[model samples]
Target: MATVRLLTMLPLWWSLCVSSALTPVRLRTLPLWWSLYISNALTPQALLAEWQAARIKSLDVDASRYHAQVLFVDDDNARARMAESCADALAHWADAGWWIYPHSCSLTEDQALIENPRQEAILTSLGFDGTRVTAAGAALAKEDLDAYDLVICADAAVRDAVLALGEESYETSVRLLADFATVADARSRALFDGLDVALAERARSRQDGGELVVEGADAQSDRDGFDALLESTLVLTAALVVFLKDSFDASFTDSFNGLLRTHFYDERHVDARWADAEPALRRHIVTGALDPRERERLFDAHMTGLRQRLSGDGVSS
Candidate 1:
């Protein structure tokens, strides 16, 4: 009798597993019986494997596919590493058919693979493989610029270097990474428009407001400066992902944005605050009054609210 009952529940159990894998929130809120069954029948590694497999299968079926190559160029390669690492973590760019290449405009051939310990640590903490970071063999050449579907520069200086290679055609394909965030929407534009002022204020507070230096005199100060830079890079890369995903499929942008938002902000209560007091939050963002930590928190909240609103419109994350 017990064997027969177990056999009868197998189909239902499989269905639940599939459903939970596709929508991970369901796994968290499973009933007592389901939870017990999962614990007894599957190890943690096995469950994770199941979930990953399900996710891959679902992604395979997505009609809105992307197949593009992207190159990230920067002076020391730190920005390029952060851009690729953050994009991989937040957007699953590899699975989405994005080929991301990182290059350094200043490093020589011998120094191409040298890693920045601080930047590597940050990427590793964010669940990316720091070993994967690499610099191009040579400086930014016209041939290199022409190879990629899009060439993203860390700043105006890097952009100018690529432009100096004397190819008018490079103008259309190459762009500043921050430009994506600024033009993404009203909120993003407002936040980024004030970013320079905010960064300047931060530098002045540290008593080193010249040339936007990220290094400091001491170890702790150095870490703090790098942390601020990393946060800025991650957020900017996220904005670029938003723009690309929206362009991939205008019809499903809401769903894609919801998924992106959940990756950035997972707190339900925080999402509620943004939904409740958007105008007040927008004011702070526009004025650059919020410090780096505060700015990240509010931005996460606002993006999370965007997810909720889109989900309410029948789009699932």
Candidate 2:
């Protein structure tokens, strides 16, 4: 009877072992869990073998993915029409499969309250949903500038106005609309062609070690600085997806740990790291007016906090 009872429990134990191996942990949470698995397992190699076996038993989806942010800037009724049409073209590209978040803004404050009815009519005729385009006369908020991955200016004046807001850093990729002209002023097709090349290049940049950082903010008088920070944090979440997707094929925890080790845990990549911790950075920066030096300090503090958490336990249980 005792031998039979012991034999009966063996199958149950085997079943549980197999079940644990079959479930693939998401790359985002894999690091902490992998560490804990190592601690409890008979050996690291043994756990790896089990994980490999589990992977063979089922398909595991890679969770690393990123979306691009694109912003269109223009001024005056004529430019607004151009911007709206351009936005519609970008939207079609987005629907086709490019991961993108696109927005349009006016360079002049006075234009923010105006609406572009003509542009709406054109967009509707193109089989585009006019409502998808924000009213033509809206201005780019100072704080919101950091949210864009690409800025398409309708003209030189609009580009200058955007750069005047301290976003000169983005000048590297900011493009002019006139660069691509058609015989019949085929604006939409030309804009789409220019954007296709531009967006493709931008996507390649992520793989080539493009630093993910918020470019700059606008100084809106009525905006609460803290609220602006919070909004900025949200904008970077999509940016983070691009970073993580490109950085690791699978297992964010392992990849991040490897990065920490190689970089010697220094704050060399504060911009990239802080971009990851924008929520906390926003909270820190909002405590006072945003000074240039304040960003470095807040990033350092945030890094310290992250190190503390990692020290106590894995990033996830």
Candidate 3:
């Protein structure tokens, strides 16, 4: 199916996570809130409410509304419980008639399923899950994120997993600065590192915010910031592809291109118009927790198209 996966990156250990480990960061919720607040677009709470509404709105009263199974990619047992509570917050979207599969990420074999062992400390310390919440039973599977219509992650961890699974440079999507305030040359570094220039300037513009005030980059606005994001992603992916193609031989090039087409071009199963079929970018920097089965399906379809093309078939443009 043409999937619109929106994942969260709550587990910072996955990649370039600057959000305080002490603070509870969620890809689908808090991190998005922070991104919007810093971007000067909406308050954290507003950002959350808006995205929830947009997602719900994406589905309607019609029983046939193509509901997206919202996935949450979190790890911390405490964080997982909190994310699930937001399930009630999902009443609106569910009433809209969409199916949501709340998901979280864990190592493929981490035997620790801490759903609510020590919730008070994590919950109180992070300021999330204001109401004490407990964890659910062991999740179906780490890779289950693919089973849904959409994936909502909570932090860079989730996004990194997406890039890693799809072979996308997932880290670049959320790599800003280790510490925005102390990073003496964040913008200069960004120029060299290929991070967003405007996002860098936003850091510079915030004179007193320091780490606390550095906004937007981490905030979540599932509706907006994605344009620049996808453009950045395409640039990076294209550059990587070109670099490999130039350095590698014809066989290697063919293999790599086949992979690219599978993820980006093959899937048109989403219930959106062509214009929205394959988004160039998205405002939300969500992640896909683990590789999805559709990953192979996409690549398989790509290979099929290539065969047809060689046979003097397949539509062009």
lDDT of 3 by residue, 1-317 (tens): 11121223123342223233223344344566665554454333334334434433342221122233434444444333344433322222223212333333332334226444344443344332444244344443534534543343434454455546545322322221111112223322222222235533442343223222111121133213322322222222222222222222333334434444544443342222324422432221211211234433444555566555545644442
Instruction: Encode model 1's per-residue lDDT on 205-309: one tens digit a residue.
Output: 322222222211222346665755655555556555555554444424333334345444543433444345444444422223224454445456556666787
Could you give candidate 2's per-residue lDDT for residues 168-216 as a string of tens digits? Answer: 6655545443222111122222323324354334423432333222222
Order of candidates by lDDT, top first?
Answer: 1, 2, 3
Question: On a 0 to 100 scale, what is the lDDT of residue 90 in model 3?
Answer: 29
Number of the top lDDT candidate: 1
Worst 10 contiguous positions by lDDT, candidate 1:
1-10
User: Ten residues in a row with the worst lDDT in model 3?
Assistant: 210-219
Name the better of 1 and 2 by lDDT: 1
* Model 3 error, position 271 (Å): 33
Off by over 4 Å in 3: 1-65, 92-94, 97-101, 105-108, 118-143, 169-317
Off by over 4 Å in 2: 1-65, 77-81, 84-98, 133-136, 179-317
Stretches off by above 4 angstroms in model 1 are: 1-65, 93-114, 134-138, 184-221, 250-317
Evaluated against the true structure, the overall lDDT of model 3 is 0.33
Q: What lDDT does each candidate get?
A: 0.49, 0.42, 0.33
